[model samples]
Target chain A: MTCKEAFQEISKYLDGELSEELKRALHEHVGRCAHCKVVFDTTVKTIELYCDGKLFPMPENIRNRLHDLLRRKFHERAV
Target chain B: MHYTSMMALEVNRLEKGTDRLTGKSMSAQPQKATERAESELIAEAKAGNGDAFEELVNRYERRIYRLALRLVGNTQDAEDVLQETFLKAFEHLPDFREDSRFYTWIVRIAVNEGLMKLRKRKSDRSEPIEDAVDDQGQVMPREFRDWKPNPEQLLSQEEMERVLLDAAHKLPASLRTVFMLRDVEELSTGETAEALGLTPGAVKARLFRARFQLREELSKVFKSEKSLDL
Candidate 1:
């Protein structure tokens, strides 16, 4: 892919929005362009690293309060 | 400006997974949570069953809270947004259509609430706000380099997690929200666009900038470690 074409379609490529023909062209470009290849590879890995993150536990205090508030609302709505 | 810009060209064609319906993404190595059994609870809750609804809150509270924290950049504000978001969702339940998954629907609500909080906080500031990044027609071209010694080779997973979290918090509200939704939460570009009320192209553009900035942060961490090894 021309560097110009790469920048324009990189987001679409990541988002899986590219057509088969375009994907082939981009892949061809990256296969030859060392810089784009590294940038593309690392970008994929970086997103994977973050996506690997676990959801942190909510504080017990807030969880309890949310329960209380929601129960209260549910009851208030029921009545 | 002679800024050194780094581009992350991750073309994970064969490796990545996407939820066909919602476009939710999962890591290549780990399977994400399976489709939640929310239909039963949603039905009961919609009919005014308090206990049933409480169970629903317990299920998604943490996910919503994390999304809020990333968007608003603080615990207190995130908690506030979380509380308001659920209340808003519950109040509007009678109007709910089962077109989308329950988590997707709630997440859309939470995004709205979180962004509202960001806007209010910005207004409360003494200084007039300026664009976080002035938009020029094109992203400036910069020298590209490989992030060698790879993430797995350079740092422990926990170390990577800690530094990435901190760096994520540093992104501006607009960028952070898009990043958290599209990348962190794995929402499809269309879902993200709908939540933020932007076009799909806008979501893609914001996501591009977010990924660019975040890649820069990752480079800094690895570069610093390289020096420490010297």
Candidate 2:
């Protein structure tokens, strides 16, 4: 596969959603191409980071406060 | 089908165990009570019940807050957005269409409110918002970098978190919202498209671009920190 074709399929390849034929082709391309390999690796790692939920942690206090506010608003409306 | 049947069997086993422990034939009493309570709450809340609304808020507060925080990238802005979202939902409760799930509808409102705040902030700043980093690297688009050896590895966990948050904030309001909804909130593409008023394809494209840009920015930050340690 050409570099452009491979680049476009990188996301699908990392997602493991690519067709076997395309996956094999892309794997071949990455094996021979340093630049494409880097791009592929970066994309995969980024997705993993986000999926792992390591990037952000919502503070417990903030969550509690928002809950309280919502509850208060609900009660006021009830009255 | 298999999984569902397995789950059913497990539930049946548990029910049998509970019945044996109680020394009586339990007749799904707890399930019926819970169902009744749920229906009553929904009915009362629909009848302009403020207390019911409060109960609903209590149930979903953590999720809503986290959604706001991820979208806004700041504690204060997130809090403001969260309050506004609940207030608007309360005011419009009577008009709510029952066709959609309440949680989904509320989430849509919260997302819109968050986007509005982001738009206002962008306009106030008067800086041209470049959502993605083009090949030129002039505006420094957010994209992931290829993982390299951690040379210095001096960045603390807090520092890395701050960098990630900063990168997210730098994303253009539109792209950033998509990223937050899709990646952070784990909303489906269809749901995200509905929330943002974009087509599913558009949402996917924006998300792909946003992820690319964020990874790039994060890599730059990590690389620079490594250099500074030298």
Candidate 3:
């Protein structure tokens, strides 16, 4: 596969959606090409960085307010 | 019990006529137990049980908030989306058909609320949320330097979050929503498509563009400049 084809398939490759044939071709392309390898590795890292749950913890105050708002709404409806 | 297990239990009960009064089959299946509990909670909430509804709220609030924060790009609007999502869900709980999982149903509501928040903010702007252009021309990797491993170790969590959020905010809302739902929220492509009212093909294409753009944006910060310079 060419670098362009490999690059286009990176997302599908990571998402586990690539067919076996395309996957093998892209894997071979990245394994041999330094540039495609960097792009593929960094893209993997990019997903990891965003997916870390610590990056965006929900604040306790916000949680409290949400529960409080729900309580009030429920109470008013009950009345 | 699982269907097969339940059938076996029923057959055993019929043959042996034992454990008929103990309800032993219900105790053996954890998956069914959880489903039964959820259905009971839904039924109770639909019958005006506030506590049961709160139980459901507690189950999904953090995830909903995170999704809202990612989509709307702020704590305040995220909070508004969270509050509005549950409020609206509660108001319409009785109308909720059981065909969909409650989480998916609530996620749909949260997405709508987030979209409304985005729409209100973008009213003066001309960019449409649905970006239909072919993004392939823009997706080529210009930065070929490998990123340093363990970037979390290099940057504080807050700094990392800022960098990530800024990169995410760079995409048009269309691609951002698909990426956030499919990647960040870990929703299935089908579920994300359904929530956004787009086809699975659209979701896949936009997800590709979003991931490529985000990687490119982040590479600006995390790339190994020393190697590239050499």
Each prediction's whole-model lDDT (CA): 0.68, 0.62, 0.78
Pick the TM-score winner.
3
Candidate number that wins on DockQ, 1 or 2: 1
* Residue A36 miss distance in model 2 (angstroms): 2.4
Find the candidate with the highest DockQ and give its number. Answer: 1
**What is the per-residue lDDT of model 3 for residues B9-102, given as tens digits with 9 covering 90 to 100?**
4334423322233423312113543554778889999999999999888878888898888888889999999999999999999999988778
Model 2 per-residue lDDT tens digits across residues A1-79: 9877876776554334578688668778766665665566555445444433333455777667766776677677557
Better of 1 and 2 by lDDT: 1
DockQ of each: 0.40, 0.24, 0.35
Which residue runs does candidate 3 get wrong by more than 4 Å? B1-36, B123-128, B132-138, B228-230
In candidate 3, which residue pairs get closer than 3 Å at backbone N, Cα or C atoms, i.e. clash?
Answer: none
Q: Which ten residues in a row have the lowest lDDT in candidate 3 chain A?
A: A46-55
- Which scores higher on DockQ, 1 or 3? 1
Cα error, candidate 1, residue B102 (Å):
2.2
Q: What TM-score does the first chain of candidate 1 have?
A: 0.71
Report the candidate with higher lDDT, 1 versus 3: 3
lDDT order, best first, reads 3, 1, 2
* Chain B TM-score of predicted candidate 2 relative to the true chain B: 0.67
lDDT of each residue in B1-230, candidate 2, tens digit only: 44324323333433343221232442312343444353465567778776777777665556676677767778788888888888888788778776665666778999888877777787677522444554223322233234555422546656765666677766777777777666555566787888778898878777777777777866775443222111
